[model samples]
Target: MSQIPMFRESFQHASKELLHWFPGHMAKGLRVMQQKLRSMDGIIEVHDARIPFSGRNPLFEDRLASVRPHLFVLNKIDLADMSRKDEIVSRLKYEGVTEVILTNLKNGQDKASKEIVSKMIDMIKSGTRFDRAMTSPSSYNLLVIGIPNVGKSSLINRIRTVHTKREGKAAPVGAEPGVTRAVQQGILVNIKPKVYILDSPGIAQPRVNNVVEGMKLALCNIIHDHKVGIDIVADFLLFYMNKAADFRYVKAFNLDNPTDKIMEVLVKIAVDQNIYHKVKPVTGGPWMEKLNLEQAAYFMVRKFRSGELGKICLDSDQLPTHTTATLSRQRARSR
Candidate 1:
């Protein structure tokens, strides 16, 4: 019988520029979001559940969240493994985050999405409204904020559907980041307590400090695919899967066996799909056509995002107090 190949312990991209993707629109959006924060009653920050521990913009907390009632929602819970939800929540609490919610924002009927409005009402009622409290207003205004492509728009649309039974999208949703360019004017989502929400563009940090953190964002598709080459992203995905000891991709991609070489894998994908590109010889010889490795890499990355390989939590391997306690109990029983 053939033995399984050894997997990689870590991933390193060829070009480690650190995936800093702050576009011009984000700069303007941040300014606009802060300007509208004074009239806002509460703030909701959305983030991808796959990489809950990293890739968050610290500027949101420093500039907008301090004065407002902040709610952190880890969206896309269906795409993430929630077995360690308590551990994830515990880590956030330690970092001074008291209000956090796990939600599948794409689903309008989800209980968590419905609870968002109620939670916002509770937070606003319990918290001070700053100088705006001088005027007794019957309605509440909320600002939805987060990093790129984390589903801020999708959440707003879902909430709007849940409460108002709205037939259409209140905000534009896209797979790519920065879909919402500017801070949208007040959008009515609930009528009972009179709630209005402002949707803001997804802003990224000026710099990504860690390479792994950048890779996580790229893999989760928070960063644009072209900025960080698809090959590099796919390579990191393969390395990450192998590091986690998951080989679901081998069968998904129809590979004979697992291999650490990214080009080898992309070549197979290209051959299987008949994807190719024309290339001229460097020596000025006849133009040579070759397999489109970049396209193949992108295909592989897309499949992973669509959950074709299998269900996975990119950050689930992170062990915390909850995991340690379980490990301790198991050890005791084994002894």
Candidate 2:
């Protein structure tokens, strides 16, 4: 029988500065969101499902969630391990989140995507702030907010397509972070009991919690790859997957076996895929062809993001082993 390979128990990196990413646009976006808060009846905060427990901007809860009925849409569920979804929802509920929905916004016909409109309408009607909304009974305005590249714009566009049957995108969508720079004007989504959604820029917390947390965000493309270093991010991905006993990347990257060293994997990927660059020697000799480790790193990370590697949940370890009710019962029994 083939023995299982052992991997690193923990991840180590040189500096935490790579994880810190708070641009000028993020600050401006926060101010604009605060200004528009009073006009909104409810909030829909979208996030990446893979890192459900990581990288959430706490400011959203302190400044926005407290005043309004907030619904969390964990987008990109297609790329996440749905088996642990119940635990994720339970943990979120414990953290004061009243409503949570797992969705894949890329699919226009997705059931969860279709449910968002009705869900928001219901939350608005049932909320204590409904009387304030009655002043403008015909329309319900909701603000879409979350950290960068969690598909805030995509969620708005998907909802618009579902309710209004409009094929054109109301908000621009991009694969990279910082796509939406400022709060956009409300776009009409539903006709009767008219519903309009305000698309706000993705706001990331100025400081990340820790290196591992930042790595999760970086791996999910919430933070720019260059900021955290692509090679370093790829290493974290390998470390995370290995610790989870997931070796799907070995097949995805065409490696003979699972190994902990990221450089070995990158070298193999570069050689097998013919990803190389011409480098000039310091001695001024002829240009030498060397493997492009950077390109290889990007290719590896992109595959994971696109769900080519496999469906994974970065916060699987953080999920509660027992339900909140069960834990409460155990505590009561102990007492």
Candidate 3:
């Protein structure tokens, strides 16, 4: 079966804001997340394959450190580079995360993925060298978390293969943030039923709490907020796409000159595709290239996300060295 298309909802500022939560709801959710963390033999931490770091719940690891033996679920592998995904899984394992599962939940029935999940669940039940539960067939609770628009619900739907209320509307997919407001649970059963996974609401990183983090998120998405213009967001994407496309690809497109400016490369693509509109200058010097580069970048990301870019993954190998301490310092200055 063909892979299901992923749905995305933009939560550009939700991560930074104190997410509006009723006192009772906040207390209840935390109690549930913590309670589930305790009784369960193992935890499954789900993240988007594209932006793994950004998709991480900033507060989750610390909250569940005591609940040892968690599986790192990297979903949407189809949108990322296979080699880079391998490298990331290895790096994460080296960084104290032992059990990692790579899956393109869009195509859940794929046999290899089923085997990976089975083996990982077996390992989770078997107990790891560092795990506290070395002698038991304990119940497992998988906590599926990620940034907004990373296909959490779609994955759940695929795994369960049914349309339920928690899955929401069926015909038209949502493209806005917080579609899955509360936590929902589902059972994963094949041959023997033994694992449960929770789909949590998308948690976004707050707006450019710092300039650098802000830029990273903006580069990935064409964000629109009072603080930044659509042009700047578009410009950032253009820069990254040009930097990412191989030299051979660039030369094939007849863009042989070396320039760090993303706008220049975009201009070349616009001209080559004949996407430019000619507007005569009153001074009669020349007709300016009328194509909007920002729109081009937006479409490029859309194409990339939709897999029309031919399995291309952008900037997946580089790891950001920004530490929590550095982020905290930058946040303090912003305050």
- Which candidate has the top score in lDDT? 2
Pick the TM-score winner.
Answer: 2
Q: What are the per-residue Cα lDDT tens digits for candidate 3 across 30-125? A: 446676665555555666576665445555576664355666767667866554466677777766677777778657465534554465566665
State which candidate, 1 or 2, has the greater lDDT: 2
lDDT of 1 by residue, 1-335 (tens): 14667876766563444555688999999998888987888999998887887767889889998888889999888787676788888987777676999898656567888899999878877776644454545788999999999999889988888889887888999998778988889899998878999999999888886777788888888888778878889999888877665666777788887778888899999999999999998889887789999899999999888767765677765654345665564334322
What's model 3's overall lDDT? 0.51
Per-residue lDDT for 18 in model 1?
A: 56
Q: Considering lDDT, where higher is better, how would the candidates rank from best to worst?
A: 2, 1, 3
Tens-digit per-residue lDDT, 1-335, candidate 2: 14557899888884656555788988888888898998998999999999887878999999988799999999999899877678789999999899998898767568998888888888887887688645548788889999999998888888888788899878989999999988899999888778999998888878887788888988999888878799999999999987766777877787777789999999999999999999999999899999999999999999999999868888977876656765464334322
Backbone clashes per model, in order? 0, 0, 3
By TM-score, how accurate is candidate 3? 0.61
Task: Write down the RMSD of candidate 2 (Cα, Å).
Answer: 5.8
* TM-score against native, each model: 0.88, 0.92, 0.61
Clashing pairs in 2: none
How do all the candidates rank in terms of TM-score, highest first?
2, 1, 3
